[model samples]
Target chain A: MSWLWGAVIFWLAAWAFNVWLANRPVARSRAVQLFIPALFGVTLLILWEGIVRGLDVPGVILPAPSAIWATIRASLPVLAGDFVQTILKGALSGYLIGCGAAVLTAIAIDRSPFLQRGLLPIGNFVAALPIVGIAPILVMWFGFDWQSKAAVVVVMVFFPVLVNTVAGLAASERMQRDLMATWGASYWQTLVKLRLPAAMPFIFNGLKIATTLALIGAIVAEFFGSPTRGMGFRISTAVGQLSLDMVWAEIAVAALAGSAFYGVVALIEKGVTFWHPSQRGRT
Target chain B: MKDTAGIATPVIEAKGMGLTFETNDGPVHALKDVNLTVGKGEFVSFIGPSGCGKTTFLRAIAALEHPTEGTLTVNGMTPDAARQARAYGYVFQAAGLYPWRTIAGNIRLPLEIMGFSRDEQEERVERVLALVDLDGFGRKFPWQLSGGMQQRASIARALAFDADILLMDEPFGALDEIVRDRLNEEVLKLWARTEKTIGFVTHSIPEAVYLSTRIVVMSPRPGRITDVIESPLPKDRPLDIRDSPEFIAIAHRVREGLRAGHGDEV
Candidate 1:
């Protein structure tokens, strides 16, 4: 009961601090921007820890944060193996192959009206198919290894990137095209010089959207069938064994990995599309 | 070769030119029975109200638009062939500089496309930047520059290839009067220095009178030429030349021609 009361007071105090920091007249530095989110996250963790302990919740249902942390420290090698197998081998490779194939297909689609009319609808249909439906079939075909997981990620990522790149190919302004025409530029020259550069922002937008999808598809597909050593496999088996702390630890690893993947892509987008209007400095 | 009156050979010739666009409403006649000739080293202005096909005519010359009837030629060849030969540079109303490119990068684009060597591209970019009085602004991005400066950078882009003929479509129409006047002077100086044949389009009477040796006045709604005023103003014009009697007479004639175009619509 005392722990619950302490958590309530701490939550109120942290909320007040965040509001005060946000309302400050001076602009926040990079450190403050990072610090504020970290503080909020810590406060939530504290509240979560206090409430579960005070309530005396059963570990099988929801383990306390300390138990989760202990499980994470104890199972570091197993987590590392799962991370490499699922993320580096399956998700990252599929991301590269899917994104590359999508870009090329987008170019071909842009070149031909027939392909645009025919393939886009087909692509949309593929995107609409649920990952659950595709995952089982892919596992059946590719066997119960990382290859099946990668195949699922590829299917999940392809359509978003294809649609975005197709749209980006059409992003060049009319006047810019006219300028190229006046120069007597060939079709290839115009595409390389004007259209591709104009498409950078939209392409990056598609790439960023695909990063999360790749991870989700790779992990979820592993649940259909994996080599007994993935985040998804561990999560499922841990739940059956009633090791809720292990499940929480896997969730934490997934959260960190997903965030790092998204952050890296966002950082690359910042570097590549720095001239975009959206990338301009805030007043 | 210049004739006795110092007039060079015809660079652009149009005869009975017509264009009709099929929009959803109906077929809109953009130009009809247009006839004109622009000689080498001449500064000709096409002045008319909005939708008068001045821009349409310019686009035709650039090979961006095709005439459904009649014949038009650039440098004694088809507009398409002339475009393939890279005989002209075109400047649009907006600056149209790519924001991603630096000022020098924008200027180098045409040169690069034409497969000019790196050294020559650098040389021409420097020359055109100096010509536009944008020296030392080579590294700045388009968005970092003022609107007027961006337009000048675009002009420098057109000038970099050193094409014999230049076509401009209301290039300064968006600028404030002060910037317009300043750019007008700089353009005249550029024309004097380069001796390139120029076809300029504008709606402003003073701008037409000040910059053009010949002004082709056009009317809209099946656009047709109503008057072709030959300016007697000398080549060396000061800003105060607008106050002179000859300038005023030309301006008045332009205004009357514009009013006549409106009257025809009514």
Candidate 2:
């Protein structure tokens, strides 16, 4: 009862603070923007801690935030291993391979009318396939290692990147192409100089989307099979052992990793596509 | 300069040139029996109502669109061969400068494609930037510039490669009247400096009269040349020249030519 009251008060306080911040006339500096979200996150954790501890909730049902934090601190080596296995070995490698292959395939499709007509529909079909439906089969085919996880990530990521890149390749304006033609630019030269550069914004959009997809695929693929190590494997085993704190800790790592991955890609996009209208500010 | 007859060979020659586009609504004749010759260092403007194939004719000269019948040549070569030889620079209706590139980079595009040395590209880029009066704006992106400035940067780009012929399809049509007038004066000065044969397309009577040594007026619906008016105005033209009697007379003739073309439609 006290926990519920504390939660209500905290929620109201946080909400009022956020509303006040939102209405303020002060410049929305980068620090303020970041501070608001960080404050909200901290408030939520504090409320979570207060509610769980005050209510004396069973550890199996929902561990307190403090317990989760403790678990994270205590199991650094193990968490680092899972991070390396799931993120470094599986997601990163698969993201690179899948995105590279998709870009190459998109270029091929752009070059040939026949392939564009034939392959895009097939790519769409492949993208529609459920990850769960394909994960087990990939695990069986590639054996229950990081390779199978990478394969699942690849399958999950390939189509989006391919479709976006193909669209981007055709994104050059008609006048721009005519200008190239007037210069007597060869097909290859035009592709290199005009189409490819013009495609960067769209291609970055696809890459940003693929980053999260890769992480999700890698983590989820390990649910089917993994080599006694990985965030997914530990999460599954932690539940059976009734170590809810461990599960929460794994979730925290995954969330952080996913966010970092996306942030890095977005930063790169901002750098590369600074000329784009969408990326106009902060030269 | 007006007496181009029996001088050096005409820079562009079109004989019975026609183009019919096959559309869903049946064949649309964009140009028909277009006969014209543009002499060396001449500034020729084509004026007509919409769908009169003025742009199509300019595009045909650029080898961007093929003429279905008759013949057109640039500098004694077929349009395609002349394009391959990089005989001309073309400016579209909109200033189609790539947004990703700076003004200097846009100007250097043709030079890079033509395999000009880096030093030569830099020199030409500087010269053309000065020509267009966008000297300090070379480092700015296209989107950062105003529409008029962007168009000037595009003109700088066209002038960079030093092509003997420049084909412009309503290049200043999108600008406001003030910017258009300023650019018109600059274009005259550019022509005087470069002496390149220019084929300009415009819908404005005053624009045609003020800019061209000769204005070829055409009608729509099976587009064909209706009349050609030779401007007797002097080479040096000020913005106030449009108020001159000679300029007004040429403008009136162009207006009459345009009305006659529209009357044929009615």
Candidate 3:
């Protein structure tokens, strides 16, 4: 009861403080802006821990945040192995290969209308297929290892990258193309100098989308088949043993990894497309 | 000047030239049986109403649009061949600068494509930047600059290759009157300095009169040339010369020619 009361009172105080800070002129400062979100996140974790402990909830049903954090610290080696198996080996490799192949395919399709008509429909069909159904087949083909998970990730991420890159290649204006032609620019020259640069914003859009899909596909495919390792394998096994805290720990790792992955891509996009209206400062 | 035919083999020549666009609505005669010749170091302005083939003729000369009926040659070669030869530079109505690139990079683009040495490219970029009075602004991106300055950068890009002929399609059409007048003066000075043959397209009568050694007045609805007014004004012109009687008379004639063309349409 005391735990419950403490969490409730702290949450209310934090909420009031956030409201006050948001209204102040000092809120516009960078440190204050960052502090607000950090404070909100801490409050949520404290409330979650308080609710679990105060009610004397069974750990098997829902683990407390503190318990999950403890598990994370204790199972560092296992978690590190899982991160390398799933994130580094499976998701990262698939992301690079899938995105590279997609860009190359997009350029090939752009070169020929025949391929554009033939390949785009096939890509759409492939994209429409269920990941669950394809994952089992891919696991059997690539075998029960990180390779199969990588294949699944490739399948999941390929279409989004292809479609976005194709659209991006066409993003250049007619006036820009005409200028290229007037300069007697060759096809490759026009592509490298004008169309490709023009298409970068679109390409980055695809790449960012592929990052999330890579993680999801890599994790999900492991459920169909995998060795006695990886995030998905650990999560499935941990749940069966009623070790929900370990499951929560794995989830925490996934969330952090996913967010960090997305943040890195977004940072690169800001650097590449600083000229775009969306990226520029209002002033 | 007209009688000096054998002197230098005209810079651009068209004989019974025409272009008919095969749109979904059927064939539209964008140009019909046009004939014109531009000599070396001459500034020629093509002026007419909206539907007139002023822009079409310029595009045809640039090899962007093909003439359907007859022959059009640039620098003693077909327009396409001349384009391949890098015989001319073209400036469009809009600046069309790539947003990703700085002004200096945009100017260097054509030079890169044509395979100029790196040192020469840098030298040419600096010279043209100064040529357009954008001396210190090369490192700035296109979006950071005003519309007038961007247009000037585009002009610098066209001039970078040092092509003998400059084909400009309503280059100052989007600018305010003050900017247009200022750019018009700069263009005259550029032409005088470079001694490049210029083919200018515009709808403004005063702009046509003030800038051209010759004005080709065209009419639409089966677009054709109606008048070719050669200015008797001397090569050396000051901005105040626009207030002269000769300038007003040329402007009034251009207006009358435009009205006569409109009379045919309605």
lDDT of each: 0.92, 0.91, 0.93
Query: Chain B TM-score for each model?
Result: 0.96, 0.96, 0.97
User: Measured by TM-score, how close is model 2 to the native structure?
Assistant: 0.96
Docking class of 1: high
Residue A241 in candidate 3, Cα distance off native in Å: 1.3
Evaluate residue A225 in candidate 2 and report its C-alpha lDDT on the 0 to 100 scale: 84
Superposed by TM-score, candidate 3 places the C-alpha of residue A164 at a distance from the truth, in angstroms, of 0.5
Best-fitting candidate, scored by lDDT: 3
lDDT of 1 by residue, B117-147 (tens): 9999999999999999999999999999999
TM-score, each model? Answer: 0.97, 0.96, 0.98
Superposed by TM-score, candidate 2 places the C-alpha of residue A8 at a distance from the truth, in angstroms, of: 4.1
Model 2 lDDT per residue over B11-104, tens place: 8988888999999999999999988888898899999989999989999999999999999999999999999999998888899998888999
After aligning candidate 2 to the native by TM-score, how far in Å is the CA of B188 from where it should be?
Answer: 0.4
Among the numbered candidates, top TM-score falls to 3
Q: Is the docking of candidate 3 incorrect, acceptable, medium or high quality?
A: high
Cα deviation of B101, candidate 1, in Å: 1.0
- lDDT-sorted candidate list, best first: 3, 1, 2
Error of 2 at A149 (Å): 1.0
In model 2, what lDDT does residue A9 have? Answer: 91
Candidate 3, A1-283: lDDT as tens digits: 9999999999999999999999999999999999999999999999988999999999998889999999999999999999999999999999999999999999999999999999999999999999999999999999999999999999999999999999999999998999999999999999999998889899999999999999999988989989999999999999899999999999999999999999999999999888888788833
The reply for model 1, stretches above 4 Å from the true place, is A20-27, B1-6, B264-266
